[model samples]
Target: MSSASFSEQSSDDPALDRIGPALSRLRRRTPASSKDLSRNLVLNVIADAPGETTVGGLAAEMGVAQPVASRTVAACIAEGLLRRTASQSDGRRTVLELTEHGETERSRFAAEQRRAFEEITATWSSEEQIQFACLLDRYGADATAWSRRQAASRD
Candidate 1:
């Protein structure tokens, strides 16, 4: 089938109809530069990781290639935003950790994002905001679950 035919078949899919534009709008609204965004995301991931973070783990968690994660980690290390050390459980494995500067940067990034969200929803009613927040949280959880299932199936 032609690409146009495939598009026509799914054009009215409700999930796509709603989510596609919302994601586009969110991308347009985000204030951080793309480099800063990558930095912030990597930093946050390291901070929140349940176990020792590694370059490979960051790549998998972020859904990016190993090389991309490695480059980003290298830059962060150079900036003193992240530190790498031998894993306690496995000396051959390198573990990632957020430095104090990384923690501060992550917190600042989150605060800025929160401020942007507040500004965008300034006129929203309290109930509307609460409902939207809850739905967004649910959507995120559902998406993550779906992603994990797909990855497991592939393996």
Candidate 2:
């Protein structure tokens, strides 16, 4: 990677520092925990889902361990971010969905992410914006693929 690309990957980059600080500030301002955020997002998905959302499926989709998903789902149930009920189609299945409050938090989180992305993209030229977006998307997919490969190796 060129120095520009290296800068793009650098956590020490001033732009990243700014974004990090902003996120940190937002986290402190909100009554959200890592588990809460994860569960809230999952609940949002489940609400729109057409079928029962299993712990294992949520784990796979969220790229987390099944236990983590189960615990988060359980916690969300406690926090009222989600509700669980027996699946009518399958007595052994668990149904999950976002509560009203969870929908609010999900909306808030999405808005914050959009605002941050907008802020970062605002400084780029149109061509740079398109290239940067493509680069970022590739980076995300590559990172996910690499992580899954690493996890499989560990197993």
Candidate 3:
């Protein structure tokens, strides 16, 4: 269906169909730096984990191989963004923690992202921007849940 049809239609499927193209355009327009993006993701995942996070756990969360996660962790360590210390609950195991520098970098990244969002939605009303933010957050959470379910089914 064309964009014109979208305005007249109220069907869920057609509305959902717009997601792919919209995301594609966004990706094309704002090409991300994969290395920086990966670092940011690693910081966020480790920060959000409920318990002490390990390299293996980080790999699972990132959907990457253990070696890949290890390499990333090593890089983060080298950059003073992450530190590996003995897990308090498990004397033999190591857990990842964000260094003070990591926290600073993560906060900086978030601020930059929010600034970009504000700029992109400058023309939008306050209510519309807030509603979109809520929906986008919900979508991200749901997507993560769905991904976990799919991975479980495969296993």
Candidate 4:
């Protein structure tokens, strides 16, 4: 058989097996930052949230414990990165919103990420970079939906 045909018959699982090691290598090669990753994740989630965000909502969205989400929110508030505002519809309910400083920080973070991405993919063609990004985004969304469905089924 031709090499191309032989390769086509190879087990698909081998390609899947490389994902974990590839991610680990990427993590190791990436430079460390002063900012905590979990905190950054929380900030991004809040900034992207569809509506008013609560600690409970954050916990659910992050798949973290309530106390963990509460503590992160508290730290963000203390750092002036976030604020608690009374909900207009409910007087007693407080929602978490990004402070002006938080907005600036988020923008900075996004820019930095974009720069890093560009640097890492500098050798790749622009079309290849865009294709990779689009595929990665679709994979993430599909994986999240699948996870939620699996969790719901378990419940």
Candidate 5:
């Protein structure tokens, strides 16, 4: 409501500053601490298909390097969220799937996130909510595009 409070960044604003750090700290877990969750999501994608999930397929879907995907998948396997069964057709290829634990954890994490989001945004009007969502989405896409251009220029 105050003009003084409104400002712009030379680069796109992530609005992380407005939300404080709890959400951001939780978000950092997304591609790291929630490795099991990510793997489970990938496995869910595979489950919809006719065949087992391959390491490379998971890697591409997660947008991570193959080695990182492999490490996360291995860790998920250890935690019993996934299984590392040897592919029947190919000895060198490992197939992954959500164990009962993986499916349960994935569902629980998803519910927690939903509850957290609802708790945070419950007071906003639907119009305000949609506007905020659009703004944040564009900010993220711009931030990512800026990063890619910066990387390309560096090279």
Candidate 6:
């Protein structure tokens, strides 16, 4: 993986030092599904969206180009994991919906991820695990907010 350099100077925080390496490892690890990470992510993004998901919305959520998202969506559709339909609110607009197969696959991937987390933290106490999970969820939320802020500033 490439170096994650925020600046010429390094941070004094020990956790910050380990974070880049940990994230790199997580990206390299594959899920228990036959689908690649991108496809799995498509299912996840669509399923988790607050409202109907369009191709443009998927691209934004994934932080990818529209064409890249479209291709991935096409692949998922061809595989019977997703379906495209006209938006109920707007006849001309299209939305993405996960098929039953996609839901099943998504559930499988999530279960595998949880299993891996359990295995890795097996030595930790149950309380410690719960605490870590809560902190991690908070971190993810904060990261997403930070990312969106950065993007908006760029725009």
How does residue 93 of candidate 1 score in lDDT?
A: 95
Q: Each model's C-alpha lDDT?
A: 0.87, 0.71, 0.88, 0.79, 0.68, 0.86
How well does candidate 6 score on lDDT at residue 113?
83
Span of 10 residues, lowest total lDDT, candidate 5: 2-11
- Candidate 1, superposed: residue stretches over 4 Å from native: 1-16
Superposed Cα RMSD, model 3: 5.1
Instruction: State every prediction's TM-score relative to the real structure.
Output: 0.80, 0.54, 0.80, 0.75, 0.52, 0.81
Cα distance off (Å), candidate 2, residue 138: 11
Per-residue lDDT of 145 in model 3: 82
- The segments of candidate 6 whose C-alpha lies over 4 angstroms from its true place after superposition are 1-11, 32-34, 153-155
For model 4, how does the per-residue alpha-carbon lDDT over 1-155 read when each residue is reduced to its tens digit?
A: 99888777874658778988986675454334635555566788888776788888789878899998998899888989899999877879988899988888777766767788899999999999999889877976776678768878887
> Candidate 2's error at 57, in angstroms?
1.9
Model 6 poorest ten-residue lDDT run: 1-10
RMSD of each: 6.3, 6.8, 5.1, 4.8, 7.6, 6.1
Clash count for each candidate, listed in order shown: 0, 0, 0, 0, 0, 0
Superior candidate under TM-score, 4 versus 6: 6
Show model 2 residue runs off by greater than 4 Å.
1-37, 44-50, 125-155
List, residue by residue over 15-108, the lDDT tens digit for candidate 6.
Answer: 7779889887876685754457888789988997777999998999898999999999999999989999999999899999999999998888
Judged by whole-model lDDT over C-alpha atoms, candidate 3 comes out at 0.88
Kindly provide the TM-score of model 6 when superposed on the true structure, using C-alpha atoms.
0.81
lDDT of 1 by residue, 1-155 (tens): 99999899888888787887888788666657987888988997788666799999899878999999999999999998999999999999999999999899888888898898888899999898889889987986677678768888988
In model 1, the clashing pairs are none
